[model samples]
Target: MSEILFITREPFAIQGNSRPALHIMPDAVYALVVTDPSLDFEENRAEPGYGTLLYKAPASSDSSDEETTGQTTLHRFAFTRKDLRSTCTEAPVVLKLLEIAKKLKAHVLSDYGALYFRDENGLVNVTEDAQAKSYIMGDKGTRYALTPDGALADPASLPAYLAENDFSFLPETQAEPRAEQPQHSEKPEKPQANSHAPAAPDYCKGMGTLKCSLFSRAYQKNVQLSINAYYAWCLSFLSGINCGYQDFPEQMLRYPIYPSTSNEDIAFLNAYCTRNPDDPFISACLALRTMRLERQ
Candidate 1:
């Protein structure tokens, strides 16, 4: 089994003063505690010094010995003045604690009691929250705060927004029935070059109705439209991509179409509305799509 080093806060003797500490549990029997010198009962807070490591004895069923309740000093570790004020993950003392965990081949448990790992960029949170994972993975384009109707919304409104939207267009799990094959093997006929061909399907047929001004106003306030205009546009945009009408970047397409809106999309719409308030929302979406394609 892998070991774990926990970073937590311990209260000082002085009121309202707390310092970061490290707790390591080698086994179920005993635990180790490392505290800053400023938290020492004999030391003055104004003049902090080296940190101390203590060994906590295991609990006993019988309260026969008084020494079992006390901790024994194991060793003293050197630290700078900046380490005294360390509290966050990037702090000096916290970095030292990470080094210690590295030496022991253990994982660093955050103050929230969740496991975390550090990289070249910074600390990465390992949790079940999708938004938190996206933020840590440098995918800020998936963190938009707009509702389906192009209205601003808070995080608390997500559940209600999701409840109101209809997602019946998504694929079903049950396999569809297959058509029976023809008994006869007939050769296909080729069409004449001069013959008129059928027109291509119109993927973006119903879009370009909502005015940019109305969208901007709705985005400024928490207004809901009678219809889900933004969702309709998203469906149209996705259809355009599927039908090869829109040439969006393959890399950017990895991000989700719904629930994850790009701030760049909102910004482009806002700027286009500032320039052409009477223009349709679909015009801004097309322009943004063209700009993204040009960037590639």
Candidate 2:
């Protein structure tokens, strides 16, 4: 499904570079923005009123936490430091958000925040290379990342990348019927003691591209294979397929695991591989076997 990736610093954490690393998909169907309580408010403030409503709370609630503090007309809620987490209405909420931000003249962005949305062509980022920390707002249900530069460069050439990576798109529609093999037109079969067997299907190529990208960037260096690596792999793999299923990789646990870490895991992975040897993640990883990066 479509998702939004919210890139933000770990509010109060004191370790590692405060760069974007977490991936947050929108958990609900609405979009909203919560204003800093310090900002002055007026009920009739927004011109032509973009259906903007003022959220009220007891002064005591503000000191408690975000959950206890506000009441919106809608229920499902999520938040970020910039308070872009609010109720989404019938209209495209981001446009309304831009309107509200302009009206409030609030210091609208974090030092470095960006909004990344998926389009037919692939994913695109609204903000590029934000200098410091910043904030982004949208109701696009897209994925996000907190990068210093706010860019996730596309693979060098997507088709070539996909092909070279050995990923294949599933047939979008029903298949045409095949003519039957000619009956009783048998030529003498060649008899050999050891004719070469068909090559094993390559399943690791694209998955390996993910591993290489992570390793080159030190995201997976010296780490045991974990779900986070798998999650990143799923994200990278989904970026290439044109299967027409918008919610590809809906959950990481559903992604295939080939080249399993143990015999038991291998048993399961092999079963999946047997059924889907040309699976996108596996095929791509096998095709792009030479994924080692050369650095200066």
Candidate 3:
């Protein structure tokens, strides 16, 4: 909900602190957490960091600067933690998150064991926007404002923060995430569950990186393969990849697969909405509830 939240104290952080520790604080009011009705732009914060509060994502002007901290080096941007925190309206919340990280003594990437993920380039790159966001949000919390390598500089501060505050993870956190890898695997050298085995899907090869973790877990067993009319349409689109132009009318709903939507499904939806007036089942249901007592 679009509601302004007044913090008991202003939130701000010292210059150096860990990203994960800062993310887990209750005093750190997330734009998503504090709003009762949720404003239009509050939920759409773009590109991580302080950008989490507002949605305007200035396209990453960052170049992939390669840096070697010696062991297994990667490309990552260099930015200060203080600069990122100032983007938020509230200072106390930001300070609280920083304090939490300082007390936890947790290294956002190392504690989470996500530092080693390699991207398509075979580099354990940390400068990528996605990588930065992952580390910033690595700590358990709804809202966050942190930067890459922000945690490495200040592990000692985290313990003190943990001593003062008691924090908990969100319920949605229990959902089986696709990307969590075991801390130390017998086959850390191998990607899939069975290293000795021949292999599984080609996509499985990307499993070692943190980016593919969630997807890897899902690919292991969650997704079921089946065919339906939508599947047929999807196949048709796939089959048309190399084909010459044909006058096939595109469907509206995902009638197929990834690019779902069928002309038929769209037609059905439109017809259903026209008859019911509310346009969708959700709207129809809401209308029903709104009028339920009125009719009586």
Candidate 4:
């Protein structure tokens, strides 16, 4: 509600360069300009008679009094692109700014048209198009297209939309996922003694395999762990089953979901995984195997 903090790259009229700056009301209602100490803006003035003055951010210590001289002086701490780029190892500039803004409960001002922020539901984007009253809510690959009345769309309404439609909506029918043909090698790891007894379940009708792309985007948006970690966790579910990348050809299994998997079914699998975080696949597979044994 209050004037949110903003980080932006300001374009220079004369120098043909853009510099990153932090916008804040350190003590007053008006914003004060701060720039890198290394940039010599005075030399690049548009006219010989025209000159502009700027506050140079302290080179070494922000706590130092040198940069905070007069009534015009603003808060001492300021950062350059290099400073931010080096410090934020987690992500690139814009993404890192979104991370900081989210943490501080602040907003970023931008002319780039798209505003990305981290929310309770993960990363969200509010983008503006060239059309007068055109806007988009959500990411690039998102199927949901939201166009509001004005150029700027309120992100506050996103939660309600999320409540109504969590992430994606699956159609009534999906194509059956085709299974990858088994590859043969001269030397292969033998299936575990118990793994072979449990034949693929009825639920696994088609050649069951999952594409790496499913996890790729999910990995990027995930904050808890690296993409590799998520991928590894997904694969870990099959380690004991002798289903995935292993020597056993006949027992090769794909993720139970296929192109034909209904939205409800996919949601169910997601819910099952969420409920049984420790071992969803193993539990499902074990249950199927038990059912088969019971029938025998």
Candidate 5:
């Protein structure tokens, strides 16, 4: 599993190149970051930002703790120290960090406090304090708090009322299942061999490009798409295929195309985008159809 160890220190605590002392665990496999006053910086800064992401050297009997701490600097952001706080969470760096976290399946942690994990929706902040209100970022960038009863407490009332509720009543959160495959008749009619390919549905016409990036991100993380997007895409792809099958039952049957409810199509698109980020999202969907045909 991927992990990241985040260490935060008091602002300006490191004087004259002195670094924080890190206790390296022998089995630790995580990306390391050390920052002043921690990564959970307060909003706003008067100057530019700066920081470093370190890759720990493999643990060895011959290596001292200091030698194993930061063997290679994977990334560094440099600016005026005063601005480092603001820059650390800038869009570009945040995206990069999220991408890294997703790849590593990293659970974001602060040395001082809080734990975070990335899911299909986005980052979820789960605190150790049961009474503390946990927050999650929505796909549309809205912030919602999880109440003790597991309801999404009103965002407007979050600050004022969330803390007042005792969290001992909080129930264990269960993982939602991925997309459910649509039920189909056990025996499907075969489409005619000479039938033309199905036309794209109206709803799907311009959706691929619009939804591609979001789908790509979730695909890379091997998670399901957001609820609305998943259902919409399913409706489009499956409806079109069903229409074609009804129109030409015989031909379509020879090359059966089973709709993937487990995100096989997303994986295909992810690979497609990795090869060419600029490729139209619809092109990958079309290619997936062809692949299914060949496999059949």
Candidate 6:
């Protein structure tokens, strides 16, 4: 499959760097400023969107960027501090973002955030170095809202500009910074695998088996072996079996237990248990819903 690398940074900084991560594909490289997280999932996507590749959130729910008034759906990728730098002129949208970042604060970038592109032949190649460019430029659209120094005339205009461009680069809104992924040291730390004192059976652990089966069945048809065994516990749920899915690691329990997500198992809990969160069972149900079952 054709894939592109995303060299991204949360702090559009001059020194900190990140490795090139694979992205599925590129959007309109010509559109000056297109969407990131892609406009397709600005709301959040369960599956790839059809046609234009954008997906809509459920009618009943609000968008990831829902406004206080409940009228506007905030765009997810608009004007993020986490900037993307690409040497491709085809990436006009990115050019616009860099210009805006400079205007916001003249923090000349330091470490190169490079994305290596691989064509159909599967030959990985370093296509460009962002440092090669002299000055990052923005599209003409930015001129309309600029002050004498070229920053947006009003803070509101930034949001408006973001809306017009479909939050392609990133939104200017402030969000609670997400926790950083824990980093491991150069030397691997060895651990005794099965050192736990054994877990007691509860609805959450028991129902994890159920999800293992259901999601596994759904996953099998989809053909993703990585998450297959988790379904075994879920399968236990299907047959009305009651046991802690954690007990047997291979088929019964496993290494690298995944954190559970309440959103995923919402339906099964509503059907089999309670809608009220006050119920401990409901809380446990939440734990098993989207738990990865096994580590990546």
User: Which candidate wins on lDDT?
Assistant: 1
TM-score, each model? 0.26, 0.17, 0.17, 0.19, 0.26, 0.20
Please provide, for model 1 over 1-296, each residue's C-alpha lDDT reduced to its tens digit, 9 standing for 90 to 100.
Answer: 22233532111111221211122211100001111222211222333222333222233232211124444312223222212221234233345555444433334454344545556776543443322322110011123243323232365743443332211111121123656545688885653221111122345355456666777776567354522566457446745565673363342434344433444455445544444456666666654553443223
Q: Model 2, which residues run further than 4 Å from truth?
A: 5-82, 86-91, 103-113, 116-125, 131-296
Over 131-173, each residue of candidate 4 has an lDDT whose tens digit, in order, gives 3213222211122222342211344654443433221112111
RMSD of 1: 26.1
Question: What would the per-residue lDDT of candidate 5 be over residues 1-296, giving only the tens digit for each residue?
Answer: 22223322121122232211111110011111211111221111332112233223233333111123344312332212211111233233344444444332232343344543344666543455644424433211234455544444474653333332211111112122546534664774564221122334456555565434556666566665453364366447655775778865532424333564334444455544443344445544554544433223
lDDT of each: 0.36, 0.29, 0.27, 0.30, 0.35, 0.30
Model 2 poorest 10 in a row by lDDT = 287-296
Candidate 3 per-residue lDDT over residues 107-226, each given as its tens digit: 223212222223586433333233443323222222333334444334554454343222322222223465775666565342322111122233422212122222222333434231
Question: Candidate 5: TM-score?
Answer: 0.26
Residue 172 lDDT in candidate 5: 19
Number of clashing residue pairs, candidate 1: 0
Q: Candidate 6's residue-wise lDDT over 1-296, tens digit each?
A: 21222223222222211111111111221111222222332211221111122212222233332222344232223221233332222223233334334333222232343433334764433434543322212222233323323244365655544433332232123232557535654664552121111122453554342432344344336554533443444444533422554454333322332333322333233322221222333222333331222111
Alpha carbon lDDT at 56, candidate 2: 36
Candidate 1, TM-score vs. the true structure? 0.26
TM-score of 3: 0.17
Candidate 5 segments whose C-alpha is farther than 4 A from its true place: 1-206, 221-223, 227-235, 250-261
Clashing residue pairs found in predicted model 1 = none
lDDT of 2 by residue, 33-96 (tens): 2122322222222221112233333222121112343442221223332233333322233333
